[model samples]
Target: MSSTQEFIDEAAKIYKVLSNSTRLKILYYLRHQDSETDVKTMVNDLGLVQPIISKQLGILYRYQLVCRHKEGTRVYYVLDDPHVIEMIDDMLKHVKHEIKGEPHPRTLYDNKK
Candidate 1:
């Protein structure tokens, strides 16, 4: 396969992982926060068990979609980059404001002239 094909295939794998709402929600929640939080927080907020979150995070880490840090016996996961957070945040903002309700105007006008 060509370089482009390889890239697309890799992207598809990440998308396949993200296609599940559980994983996507995990990513979304992790996207904003810089510091690593424990799985208990995920369970408390996302209602996912520690094992399940660990499994999904493993998949994300395998695909280079997330990074995990080991702190003694506990492992913490965070988005691989700030860009990932920015992209997800922008996407959520777009969907929430543009598609979920009446479409908000795309541009603002000034009457200073």
Candidate 2:
């Protein structure tokens, strides 16, 4: 595979979106839920203001990282892709190993060299 500036810039957008702790929390919450939830539910569950939840959700929605639907007057959200959970899990694992001073397995790029 080749790395291009365009690909790197596009990939950076995803990391930027996930960089916000509140967005990560929202993703984690939705990942564990059996059903989609509205902004009110998220606000209550996260203890955040509705506007804040809505704003973060807007970013997720724009990136298609979350599925959103409107029923009646309320909009509900859920995880759009299961891979996001796996990505988050893998990143957390890497961070945990770094924190513990444990040697990490060779990454894909490392193996490519």
TM-score of each: 0.71, 0.84
lDDT of each prediction vs. the true structure? 0.76, 0.92
Question: Runs in model 2 with CA error above 4 Å?
Answer: 1-5, 106-113
Which candidate should be chosen as best, given lDDT against the real structure?
2
Indicate the worst ten consecutive residues by lDDT in candidate 2.
1-10
Per-residue lDDT of model 2, residues 72-110, tens digit only: 999999999889789999999999999999999987999
| Clashing residue pairs in candidate 2 (N, C-alpha, C atoms within 3 angstroms) | none
Model 2, C-alpha of 37: deviation from truth (Å): 1.1
lDDT of 2 at 44: 89
